[model samples]
Target chain A: MKLIKIFSFLLVLILFSNCHREDFLQHNRESVKSITGTWKIINAVRNGTDLTDRFDFSRFKITFSDSSYIVDNSVPFIVTQNGTYHLDDPQYPFKIYFETPDNFTKELDFKYPTTNGVRNIVLTFSPGCSSNSYTYTFQKIN
Target chain B: MRKSLNYIKRKISWQLTIVCAITALVIAACSITIDSIDQSDSINGGETMQSTLHVTISTNAEEDNSRLMVAVLVPKVWNARNNASISFTSSITDGTQKMTAVPVGTAAPQGNGLDWPTLINNKIGHGGNLLPGWEWAAFYSDNAYNVGGNINLSVTVNIKIKTSQDNISFKLGYVVAESVDGLSNSQYYNSAFPGCFRVFGTGDLIDFCNPQLSTVDPLNSLDNDIVTLNFDGGIIDNALANQSNIFLCAKGITTDGDTLNLCRQDSTTQLISQGIKKWSIDIWPRGFFNLPADKQLASIQYYFTDATGNVKVGSTGDGSTPFTYTFKCQ
Candidate 1:
């Protein structure tokens, strides 16, 4: 009887530990859902200078649905493109990989969940040797 | 009773050991199958794989007939699989009628060098038609494949000209004149002002709608005579604008088969406004007229140099058979 009681206690402990591990994995997957929706660019800055007035930030919008995204920018003659995007991690300091139709690929670093529904995306483009960084602030609309 | 208990315990222990061994065997088999599937996916272009194809067509000026050299390049990722081949088909349309270009011959795949025929044909060995000039129908068999990252597969075709027809071309953007002041005026190059104008020797002026034919006599030096080249950023890639240098160079060929550099304008900077980067260059004819009358302006070449030092030369003139344009002086 004593041996059976000890085995029963260990079985319960093992099952509980397994459930805890599964919960952690489930949370990681659910985090990606926060980024799915319509986002509009509210502020844009490059380096230490504000570029919102220089660029038409109001016309720029990005819509994310599942693993695909569409970027619409009217400032540069009503340009529209759809591409595939992926997030390396579902947590903070997310790394994003974007592939466009013209075979242009870019990797951007993102800081998200700033205030619960806002995301701060930072894109660094270095053509040749000079590095130019652009930081865009996006607010979730839908 | 003690003997029976011992027998039962021994039997249960043997059963447990067998069950553990079977479970381990099942897991090992599952792992090997999963690994095999992943390897197969990588060899084939799986859902996660991405690739691009680039095609370029150029005229073979050395050949007497109108021959077009077509080059097809595939990304390195596409060639990772064994026995990978690409089949290509193209058609050229000249207004009302369309004709297919036929392959003259297949030159071997050129590796890294841009040189034609000799080097490429010796390396890969080509299989196609050997006729010169453009063909009514062209086809490249599935023998072309990317050897490596830098190397590309190229094939040459002859374009057959049935009738004198103008090939459809698209003008992504155009150069426009800015107002007399520094401020930009959309109306300066519109129908009202007509962006192009000519100055005659009699001190008379005429505005022409066609900018290419805008002429000026060498003697007219009274007017300011300014022409602006407007570049629409919307039509071009913004990334290219940020890293490219736009300039105009006047090239002339001597009878000795030498190229003469007559004059080159300074690099132009683009103005960013309303999401478009408008690049304009002002040309003062006074400086252009200083060239000796014997030296004719063969062509006005618009050159674009990218960040990687790759230069693309284009001209604003008629497309002739030999691909040579003469800047006629009035």
Candidate 2:
């Protein structure tokens, strides 16, 4: 009975150690990649206007790398803009930020709360005009 | 086979342990987190962010074109909302010399002629186009006539921005008869009087009026002169017209005040077929309001009337003949 008890204790200790080792290995492999690619400006709206102008339907396109982006105002690559971007992810789901030369910084947050399981992202910004309200939505591609 | 399997297991275990250690290190290195995020949802990133935008706008009064140009400097970051919506307030300088010159040597639409009524109609405060807040008031200083026969006249110009409560007052200095010799030095040529001048009947300075001093040879001989004016300082190339007709007239104000008796009195004695003489003054501003910013160049030309009343003969204004310099802004 003494020998059996000793063997049982050793088995428990080995299992516990192995489990912790596996957990540590798993954590090491987790890494988030920086997003870089083409982004489409789905829609833009100027608040407080009588909705008389066709500016609401206007769409823009942008391309971003790790460092810089461009705003194009011509055809084929209509309204290509270049700017800088940053990221914030204190919470589980990460947030994106963009700053243009016009001294405007857009802090983008997800409209629908995301969790660790979320593979796609949608961020929104506010204060579209001089008013207290704005909403800019962004989606992750690739 | 059993020995190989055991060896592989050992290697896998060691790899796992290394990976776990690296992971822990990474998390520890990146553990820092920001706190006290802005709870209040302020628009435009708050007042501190909005105040970062800086812009300076300058408006130049081009009374000749009846337009005021507003120049804006947009910092590289912020884009302009509506560049076309920029506005301007008008101002005028009338140096009390109602008698400005008319160039008879050039063709109509490009030159000034004996049409005093129309010529006087197109100035800054005239033509019924004076802005509501812009009033034409003339003030003179007795300094022109002191104890001695020394002339030191200075005219006061009041420019008020009707849209804003702010107003600016500047003085346009005049020249004395003795200082007339200063005209020979192009750098120091000014009108006898500077400031807005209303025609005798009208209460506003003519929209297109400029300073004029004339001398005539009434006996049809260049040696016999009627009036001689020497400018102490004048704006080099600023003009009321994109293309201006500059002139130096020897004029006589008739007692009737109905007709302005005038003749082209050139320094030369020979009388050309067409009597009227004209000049075209061209000088572009070196740069915007900041004068010392650029190197400026100017050109002067003299014209004599042809049979068709067109200016044909062109000469440089080295002051060899009676000539006037008219400056225009682009």
Give the number of the best model, judged by lDDT.
Answer: 1
Best candidate (score: TM-score): 1
Q: lDDT of all the models against the reference? A: 0.35, 0.28
The per-residue C-alpha lDDT of model 2 at residue A11 equals: 96
- Tell me how candidate 2 scores on lDDT: 0.28
List, residue by residue over B1-330, the lDDT tens digit for candidate 2. Answer: 999999999999999999999876443221111111111111121011111101121112111121111111111111222211222111222333221112222222221441222222233223222221122221112122111122222222122111111111112112211111112222222122233322222111112233332211110111111111222112232221122233333222222332222334332211221122322211111111112312222312233322232332222222334342222110
lDDT of prediction 1: 0.35
lDDT per residue (tens digit) for residues B50-108 in model 1: 21122222211111222222222112111212212222232332122112222334332
Fnat for each model:
0.00, 0.00
Model 2 B-chain TM: 0.15
Name model 1 segments beyond 4 Å from true: A1-30, A75-80, A91-93, A116-129, B1-330
